[model samples]
Target: MAVNNMAVQGKFITFEGSEGCGKSTQSKLLLEYLKAKGLDVQLIREPGGVAISEKIRSLLLDKANAVMNKECETLLYMAARAQLVEEVIIPRLTNGVILLCDRFLDSTLAYQGYGCGVPVEGIRSMGLFAAKGIQPDLTILLDLDVEEGLLRRGAERDRIELRSLDYHNRVRKGYLDMARKEPARMMVIDGSQAKDVIFTQMCARVEQLLS
Candidate 1:
């Protein structure tokens, strides 16, 4: 892919976590914080951020699609990602625009592969192709109790969120395993901590990268 050779002048940061772990809120806050520091930053989300990808996101999340198999789910995610990478992410990063993504390739690995029993090796290969060689500079994985996270989500749950507790637990485990294997790139934060505390910790890690 020609996009692979493009110089990434800005940082690419992504947030990962189980449902209702506050990654969306945290990513938003980080976006604001980065803007306050006068940096050129934008917040985009997986399965979204572009018109085509956003439609795919809706299809993937709609509870009506309950019968969708793991293979179809995984392919849809990759389709959206490929569009997002080509349409928005690559060009922005090439122009030195810092990007804060709510979720990325890791979500597929955890949700479809680990949680839904899809083959991990296959997902990794597809993810690499979908992302077109654009890897996150930093990944913040927010760790939280599955039950508590579900409680936070309340009655409003998407297709993925409506999965069994065991499934979500497996997803969390997958995330932690990945973090353990790549400690330098993935930072696991205690999502149970106070919002301000978590924010501060996130800032510290991000600033270290910026410096």
Candidate 2:
């Protein structure tokens, strides 16, 4: 269960997308499939479920903290990520588990760097430091149009999702850009399709990776 040995056995795969794009749904389906196949899997979401990360998530998402600055918000996200990585992700993966993260570092880059207009370099630096060089083996990006995605959510906007339409558009563009830049490590999925169709394709992609 040492770090070096874990890195060799475990695989990290992350799902990323804007709100209402069904990343969560797909992630759940994938997790179930992996479990059924008898693979050791761990599911984690950002901003998060772990003790320390959950506290940071509360601060980041609380409507009452409306005055939090953009940079401060980004840093808070990094803090949560650092804790989640150190406490949960690293340990679980080290035990040879397949880590299926609902949202990972890409969310920070999309929401903070592109949507909020923070410099991409700064966000990347912070992410690198937070994750301590751990990178997903594959990143599945569920791509969708901002307007269509917003309509799907139907008035259930969280603090991040409540941003301007223009901001959401930029975030989507940012994800596409990242996929393009890291073609070997990322796959862009058509998220506008029906849920079953998306799930089927997701399974195929995962099967191919495992094969």
lDDT of each structure? Answer: 0.93, 0.87
Candidate 1 clash pair list: none
Q: Which tens-of-lDDT digit does each residue in 119-139 have in candidate 2?
A: 999989888889877888888
Give lDDT: candidate 1, residue 1. Answer: 19
**What TM-score goes with each of the models?**
0.97, 0.94
Position 81, candidate 1: lDDT? 98
How far residue 189's Cα lies from its native spot in candidate 1, in Å, is 0.4
